[model samples]
Target: LVAIPPSLLPCWTIHTSQWSLENTIRRRPLLQLGDNSHRHLNPSTISVTTEREEEPDFADHNTRRSEPIRVDLPKPATRASTEAGGDDFMSSDQPRVVESRPSALTSNPVHEAEDEKDHGTVERPLVGDQVRDVIRLIQCRKCSRPLQEPVTLPCGRSLCKHCLPETHTRENISYPATPNRLQGFDCPYQECGRNHAVGDCGVDVILTKAVDNFKAEMEKARETITTAEVSTHVVIQRPSAGQTGTDMDDETTSRVVKGGPLVAVYTLADSGELDYNSNVTFAEVSSLGDEATAIDNRTFSKVKESVRTEMDCQVCYALFYDPLTTVCGHTFCRSCLHRVLDHSTYCPICRRGLSVSPLLYRESCPSNEHLKTIIQTFWADAVLTRGDALAAEALNRHREFDIPIFVCTLSFPMMPTFLHVFEPRYRLMIRRALEGDRTFGMVLPQRPRTANDTHFVEYGTLLRIVNAEYFADGRSLIETTGISRFRITRHGILDGYLVGKIERVDDISIAEEEDLEANETQQALERYESAATHQSEDSSTSRPAMTTPEDLSKMPTSELLSLGVSFVERMRQQSVPWLAQRMLTIYGECPNDPALFPWWFASILPAKEYEKYKLLETRSVRERLKICCGWILEWESSSWSLSDCRIF
Candidate 1:
């Protein structure tokens, strides 16, 4: 028995497992070396014997020996001959192993050739007889299929052109195309872990041809086996009860016995023909890695659409952004689901009731690993398409209509708000903002007992980011200034951040100083006349006699303006409250002009939000001032305890 070396076990075992019994018989042949007992055997005269093993039990039996069939093997192909194909064919210095069954026998006696000087040298097998399967272990690790258009890397491993890391496209399709040498990708194989530029690799045409030839042989063998199996099966008629025949059968059945690992069984069709394709066996799923698990010819052909669909958000119909799976075994993008739950406490796909509180926490809804692996492996094109689409969508998003929001403290116009963005959602938000408009809204979150009640006040300020400093960990310190006030028309979440459609709110500006002065004069006269009428109605005797409109018309216009101004001054001179004074100190001083003073005071004062809400409701500057002046007077006279104060 010729013992197979342990070093050859991996290759031989893989070959045995891959091919059927018939293929094994057609491929392997028995060979024997000249025995020392033969006295005519000279050291210089090397003798080789070859035999064709046709029986399946050839390896098991060693008692029989055939007559010595002395034959000469052809020389190995020269490097110059292979290079004729192309420069891609680099001649290998390593000794090539080949197998062949000699067709012609040499009858010359060994003693006659003993005197020859070059008699001992045995010729290498011919190139045509070389078995490419010997190098099958070096096939591409990714596809586990033989390498095509092989590119030998700097790491000394050759892989299919498509399997190289440099061949992978950018995640963002909109990104400018760059050379493969600049991509800098690490090798996928763990055994030879190294990083190299794509340009550094060269095509190995010899290796590519070898792999292609091996695949061709495998395909031809499979076709032969399929044809033989189909032809061997013929329908046999059942014998009658009166007839006693060796081939007699009560029920009809068709079976074919073949001397191989797999039996060629066939089913008879109604037309008395064998169904060649029916009941075919398939190879077991190999445990190669993520690529093999998620992608195969069967699965790929089954799902003809891109694999990215499995990782897409049902609502957005895009690749998942922070994916989350529901308890109903349905998966969705986290932000899309959150926005869906905002309207109802049920899952988007299944209508099953889900608690809103837990979904609010990212930890409670982790990404699906299987889907993620599928995307990262077999969906490069899909990922790039989705990323470009998302980037374009973000760029087109309007600041007034659909701006992302930071739901925290309130920010006023012209005020600076510093933020430490650490949350992954917020980081994504900041990154997107920087890429687009670099602007977002800041609104105060409604203080609810539970996190499930995620709400934001209607009024918020738009902040334009100035500069942001990002840390290595993806955290950022952003500096921004409130650009303008906006009231939320509608609210929703994207990815993980809040987004809203807002209308701009600004202090009403006058076109001219003359028009403002005229309006102020008209307002003072009207207020004075109305106040006089109100006093007279309250107490006729105590109050001064009311003047008729005709009489007031007779009075000088200058006198009416003077009286209104005096009344406003008296109210303004009254002792300011502690809360109002603290606000003035912190927010700097209020505006000197009476027309602009009310707006400045309202923004800084520590007043009830409802009161501030009322201030925001009015368009006239005079009306807002009147409300604030009245409140100040009431606080001074009522002697109410300070404990009643509540910061808004």
Candidate 2:
């Protein structure tokens, strides 16, 4: 895995950029103070704020007082503007009288009604609903009003200080006061909502300053920001039905009233130099940044709306849910990303091959944490509702009983199943299984004798993946071990493979310790003694049995185990072909425990696959051993020889 620096963490970075404090901020004109002469800005470290009015109470919400708020915005100047530049927006630091008109914004709001009733506050002429619709970046996300005591959250969004304690009032989440229980809540921002808790976040000093400046600038703009937004992008309001034709004498006509359309006037052109009627005024211009650096109030609101569109996940056609960014620099919801990977090991957005991504083999997150936080901070309520729906859907899936099945080979319990997945259907199955619980079922193909059988063998093993290596061609090599055997109850087809519901097959040795039935006991003893007579006549083992077949019959399991272990030791010493070095390396040394020896012997026993299949069918350990011991006695008596057991 690549080791990214802390400052560049949560994303990849380009190390070559000169990131220094010297020339970080390239300023632009904050506001135009004159309509006669245009002055281009020269971005600088030091700024000179010319206060045109002395001791002006910018926050006097009691009346419609006129105040001139001045800010110095310096930037690189164009040749025409620099040569013809007279004084700044004013002659000196003195207020200049200009024809002013009251800006239109709705005074009626949900919070305002509550504040007036509870706090006995007077209602001033605030921004109207049409203006509020276009200006939202500087307001409180929770209450949809100007921020009071703005607090910066961990998510990098600004919130009012009063919003944190209202978690209990807003949602049904209970914040228990138990000392041991962790205190936190799910994030509310819809785009990247997750769990979060209140931390030691005081009022953000920078955001407070920005908000204070905004309030002062907002009041000042009521008297000044009426002429133009930009050269072509202008803000225009339609005339009322009773108004006369273009005898435009009234300046208050520009004001948008309640229920008026918030039209964004566009005059886009393809010419190198813009052509315009000299009648309409235009905003001061500057060079835009990478995308844009300077913007008017209208531009800011439009950018916020555009960003909302980019936050949606293409796979689901909705907002991101646990978003993860790929190494290819594209982002998708984490669940959608893995679902795409199941079909093809490539990015859905760019189709970049992800076979070499370090994220696949190990469990490290490449999630868009900062993006989630910002989204959570914006639409917390909507995100909470979405999270609840997603959780319920996930719960329903877990309650279902379907499992993918690979019908290629016979797999026994507690044994390895090595696989080279080349088929497209099985590759997709393996990828999905690895991404999920790392489990799937393995069953043997139907034999010709059971030609009527449309599906695979009923009995199979559930394998858990241990390791895997993927190739560029989409094939993968994987190593897995059998977890348990299962019996298929119902089956269906998925894609090109099989999926089934199964029940686990556990060993049934609960009755093994009890005495066998009278007739069955007699039959077992006869079988052992008859085999014992041959052991005496033509035995390969040099050692004598410590107990006879008579002692073994009373406790049938232990006696059979003794018989099997001695025969295995004799054959192992004899260097039988099936017990060769390769076989030992693959399956490991023979197990000594009676409960385990049956599976080991059945694996390497040079018998037909159908005979070996019986081991999986029987649940009792004693029955499985009888099948193994019978094979050994038969192989010993006859001059039997064969090649190694077939794995494929």
Candidate 3:
């Protein structure tokens, strides 16, 4: 058995010895040398030797080594290098040095120098790249195009061309492109090239801003030009009083010339210079505030070159003069009111029912009429002074022709057909008509009423009274036929009745059939037979054949008249009671077409006053036939039972 010494015993027991003891000895020199120190070691100065005393049970005698020699020198001022070949100094018996502080020097000086370099060293600013990239990525906000140059906004942002100034500068400062700032430019990007403002550097920032601004300015200029070109020119027609082409001998020759009114209202800016002598009526001047200014020699030249143009009437598009308000509270020019009443009895503005007879034209209008008389008085005076020439000039502005007109007065009554009883005045009208050429012109009254007085349609047919009968009530029932459609040129009250200047419409009559034309005669005969038998329940009432010239002439008139009456009666029989009712209500006993025998018969047969009025106003014979046919067709299809039928 081997005896173990106290120090040797610790080495002999496996659990008592440190496992890192050899590793610590080998690595101890590296830690003590610091990270960058260099070491000098010679192989001859250190030697290893083996010594044998007694062999242990598990020990290899050949592997046993002598402890290396230890040397303690003053610690080096610098650390050692791993690449200095100093590994031979590390051994188990020699203690290794431990480092107390990190070394200042490092082997990676090149890498450290690179990390310390400035981040701004990149020659070009990323702002320009960012701007270009952003502009390219986003299409134009307005026109949606990528081809436009990017505008470098003062907000240090960029946008495509064609953006509005309001959109860009609402909150952010925006730089506009102009020549004033193009020479020296500042980077728009914040903190980029902070030494320069937009006009201080040479980076062409000013040029970019200028280009964008120029494009916007050009667009504004183009809009102005387009507006000027598209504006409506006022046309004034001035007629020289009493001047005719045939009256060349007259010294004070009156001529008609057309031009716009001196005052005009404009809503846009006008950049063009004003020329008073030129034909242009008015031009827009400026849009400084909410109000727009326009220039005409008469109105704007005196008021500091800018004045509010008068508000125009909504109906006439002219400065309101003598404005009148309807009961519906709608305002219109006095002249416009007159014209509207000629066409319709309703208010022009609200389309409400109106009584023209009570309409009053006065200087003071209703509260809703914004325009006062002060303005109107001045405008009216100006118009009267200037209107004659203007009207003459405007005369050629519209095509002119003489229009035939007709006028008639209502007369007589048939129950359910005509609601109105014959008044005393219309009886006088019939007596007057009988004393004349049996013809009377129909004219609409100046004012219409819903009740008590007569109202006539604007266009009425001329009437020729053919037959008359005196009734017990001192009323006269007259049969008449329509002559032609006419337009009333002028109307006036005459002898308690309406009288009018009416031009007669010349009829283009179809050629009359010769006596030898058997086919026409047979057709006429058949038409007469159809008319006579149209509504007769008794076959005995069938028309007799006409064999004489007088019969031929009279037969057509009788047949046409009978046909019109039969058509009405048939409509009433076929359950289309409305047609009979309408006819009765319109025509009454008085003939509708009092001038034409056939139309007069048609009107008297239908009891309605409105139906008579329709016949009186109907211009074309063909149209009358069409209307009659429609009624017949409607009657045939209806399910209403037939009632007592009688001719008036």
Per-prediction TM-score to the true structure, in the order listed? 0.28, 0.35, 0.22
User: By summed lDDT, which 10 consecutive residues of candidate 1 come out lowest?
Assistant: 81-90
Best-fitting candidate, measured by TM-score?
2
lDDT (Cα, tens digit) per residue for candidate 1, span 1-648: 011222222332223344233232221111111111211112232221112112221110122222222225443332211111111111132222122112111121222211231212222211111111122222454554445676655444556678777444222111111364344467676865644444445465334443454445334433444544222332333344644332434334454322111111111221223221122222222233232222222222222122222444667665554445553445665546645653455766668655223234432233443333333333332233333333333332322235777886655555555677888988887777765657788876676666544466667777877655556887766656666566766555566567665555543322112123344454355555565556543242241232333333322233333333343344345543422443333344544444445545555555565565555445434445555554444343345553564423
Best by lDDT: 2
Question: Which digits, one per residue and each the tens of the lDDT, describe model 2 over residues 1-648?
Answer: 111112222211122133232143232222221221211112131132211212212121222322211112222222211100111112343232221221121111211211132211112211223223323344566654556676654334555677654342212121121221224444455643533334313465434444455455344333232432322222232233444222254222122211112111111111101111111122213222111212233333333233344556667655565555553445666656645653355766667654222222212333444345434433232233334334444333322335788887777777766777888988888877765667789887775465455446778888877656567898766666777777876565566667765665655312111213222454455565565566754453654343332343333565567668778778888887777766665567877666688888876666776678888988666667777776665565454443432321
**Which TM-score value belongs to model 1?**
0.28
**Candidate 3 runs further than 4 Å off:** 1-438, 442-454, 461-485, 505-601, 604-607, 617-619, 641-648
In angstroms, the error of model 1 at 341 is 37
lDDT of each: 0.41, 0.46, 0.32
Reference-based lDDT, residue 140, model 2? 61
Candidate 1 regions off by >4 Å?
Answer: 1-401, 447-454, 467-478, 506-586, 593-599, 615-618, 634-640, 645-648
